[model samples]
Target: MLRAMRYLDYAATTPVLPEVTDAMVAVLTGDFGNPSSVHAYGRAAREIVEDARDRVASAVGASPAEIVFTAGGTEADNLAIKGATRKLRGNGNHVITTAFEHHAVLDTVEWLGHDEFETTVLPVGPDGLVDPAAVAAAVRPSTILVSIMAVNNEIGTAQPLAEIARAVKGANPSTLVHTDAVQMLGNLPVNVHELGLDFAAFSAHKFGGPKGVGFLFARSHAPVEALLHGGGHEGGLRSGTLNVPGLAGLGVAAEIAAKEVDHKIERVGGLRTRLWQGIEDSIERVRLNGHPTERVPGTLNVSFEGADGETLLLLFDAAGIACSAGSACQSGAIDPSHVLLAIGVPREIAKGSVRFSLGRESTDEDVDAVLEVLPGIVESARRVG
Candidate 1:
């Protein structure tokens, strides 16, 4: 009998929900119009875009006016970090971020440091947690922007955004706080006020919406310079015509996620626990990465000892299990996870890391499928590797 395919990579991206697809189809076909135009068709398209803006804003506890749509989370991160850094250069050149932030923020900050900006990347402990006190110490009079991720994309560790924000604010009230919250919007509780965030980035595709659609939440007081020089769209923070269909789908997806968040967390968390327990019972020397209790519900990055990471992934694939070795953004990277190394995992051990991210569609049978196949897959990998 052929093994059934089991997908467990929600952190990378999610399939669009039926409702979201329906909304997207309507906008793409019947409601298609230029949002910038003054005509009737344009007005209709513009309304859809604004409505999506509102939906995303409400989900994050921010005002609609604060939401600026971007092409995706990467663009949102670029806008938040680069835009803010450019605007605040005269005030200060120093910025602070975590060592394990996604490349979007990491590379952007590094690039900024190449010329006009000074940056400080803080370290995370074995638990993949950034200390709030460290952030406080890093804050300087010249610190202009502090960027951190709400959740680590590789291990799914939830950073203490609220505590980190408080630290940054306590150190310097003038410093702006930006968080890459692409992984938190649908998977965890996201409230800008509660987290005290000056800026945040969210990707719709991470939450069962269309790809290539995301937004940045900028506080009214925190103004970022434009990344693109064009018709001055998106409050001059970003330029170019809006993605009406993608935005419409994103709005619907956000609304659905908001309404179903509580149940999804509880259910997905239960599934994660079941998976962890199963793996612990079935395998020896398998270390769990990320925080013990502070992680989101759907993510589990495990390092399988005595098994080659690449070979193990192939074995799992042969068994019809779909997962990841690192962030989907680095789909074919051969290097060990930078996240694992940052958290103090040895290079040899990091090479065995594999991430299994559950999602809304996951069920008990999916978890069982992992339990059934993983042990044999590990044995096969160890034999060959």
Candidate 2:
């Protein structure tokens, strides 16, 4: 029997590839040991954790000593933002970031602000890109950290990280620059050194690995305090017992992703362009969000005027086409995406936006299926409502 539908929500999460699953399963069934114990079994598990760290670090142009694993992207972001901000509290209390950042970063900064730190959320341009000059202007003498995302989850806009890092460092070399690279890790080329960032966050599931594992890359010189207090683990920055199976899966996924990134980019970019072209040719009253050329290769966000995003999503779901209204983390909420609002999209249009994110498993047939079904769904939604 033929499958009824297709999934295009790679931005939310990806299914674990067979190889990644096998790697994790081996650890789960064969060498199940608590990495914190002093026994030989624990040592075996700890070795797997360390090996995964090296793979993840090498994929991002960092050393194994710099990688710290966490539960996932949210924990990694919280630890990087809250830990760095609190550690630098003695030096300063102000922080700067973009308004278009994922809620993980935005909410974390807001919570930090409530805790007595000052925060400046810089506005993005119409293209959803932040100006380095604006970032520099927002930095106060008391600013201790600058947190920006490598890619906007809603619109797939890629930030000028290298430039922003340079601007922040030039303004105050002591002001650490951190980027949420969770969405960018598999879709784009990421080198922490080339970006000039002091710290960065990444999640394994975003790149075909297990869901429970992620890592933060903190430069050797960057000062950061631990978010969790427990048995000394992850160099005291994160203290929970390591997830051995998840770590093994992450290691295999990282190595595979690093080797295939260039080819994936080329293939996914072509698929995205094809999908966009079909939408442009068939759909009316549609608008594309984010910088057309500066966005991620496999993400296409568009708004259909006068259509409700949630309704369209349901219709698409019935048709077996899977996508998202915005960031999956924030999808259940009623409010429109803050990212679209930051880019100056009207509230009504923003409420109608849909994000189609491609992945390695997507194909021309999948794109064609969506192109065939989406226009009718939009038209039907417009007519009924």
Candidate 3:
């Protein structure tokens, strides 16, 4: 009902909640201060940041001392991969990750490869689940870090992190296990210790908080070197002046998400299933992407044969239904999705896929509207293609 279009791209970024916005506004106007300064204002700002860190940590079963705030998920991913690799330079120049990782992890590993480091990209099965055995087999004697995302952003596929972490640690006790948990934070239970991960990344905007705020969870024993060099902030692991207002919003959002995730999951999961069932009942020559049941409850990705994703997206837009061709960052590209291809989808169908992500705010009426609009859009796109 917004601008006559129904939004279905919550995975890309969520709208900030009114409570989170109010918290941020209070900080921006009333408690504005540089955390590094030596004054009452500075102390107040520092206290806010610290309390926010504690809330975020509690949400993920981490300690406040282990959380290092960053600009966003991408920066957190870069810091964890690059910083951990740099710290273990003497141990080896080898790292291991999955083929289906987001570009942040994939690109960082590619950059490391350019620097003479050997990287092994493990393959996922057609189910889009990485096998723990594959990771254990890929680990070389020189392997120093194993990084994997807790959930796939494109398809909402959940990786077996607990199994993967145990395998990595068993193969090489010194090797660090890092997971990008940005998409999994609000949708799933993310206990770092329970998952046996050394480091993990999260972003606020993914969970109805303000953007440009994220955190990296680093275990005490698996400390990474500072990626940014200045100001000695975040225990010298990430150095820069803190975003006080954004941090406050993040804290409020995290607490709200933690308290409401279970109920939200049930509601959104039902909506996602209704959408998927509607599509399946109406459409033909369509394939669902990712694992059948082992995915985030709020996301559904589907590939329609003989259709162009970009064309279908436009058709749906014209009909007042908002969806995505693929990842927001890669929307302009014409090539097939690497994530879809990794899961063994045909290139042509991959080119015709769209991701529909639901959120806590989605209603049954919104779900029905999409069901009414999408089949015709897909039919039209296929005929045109």
Backbone clashes under 3 angstroms, per model: 0, 0, 0
By lDDT, the candidates rank as 1, 3, 2
By TM-score, the candidates rank as 3, 1, 2
Least lDDT summed over 10 consecutive residues: which range in candidate 3?
Answer: 1-10
* TM-score between model 3 and native: 0.98
Overlapping backbone residue pairs in candidate 2 total 0
Q: Measured by C-alpha RMSD in angstroms, how accurate is candidate 2?
A: 1.4
Provide TM-scores for the models.
0.98, 0.98, 0.98
Candidate 3 runs further than 4 Å off: none
Q: Encode model 3's per-residue lDDT on 221-285: one tens digit a residue.
A: 67589889998999889888999999999999998888888888888999999899999999999
lDDT of 1 by residue, 1-385 (tens): 7567899989999989999999999988898899999999999999999899889889999999999999999999999888888888888899899889999999999998897688899999899999999999999999999998999999999988999999999999999999999999878878998999999999999999999999999999686899898999998778899999999999999888888888989999999999999999999989999998999889999998877888887778888888999898887765788889999988988898899999899999999999999888988877876
Model 3: pairs clashing at backbone N, Cα or C within 3 Å: none
Off by over 4 Å in 1: 1-4
lDDT of each: 0.91, 0.90, 0.90
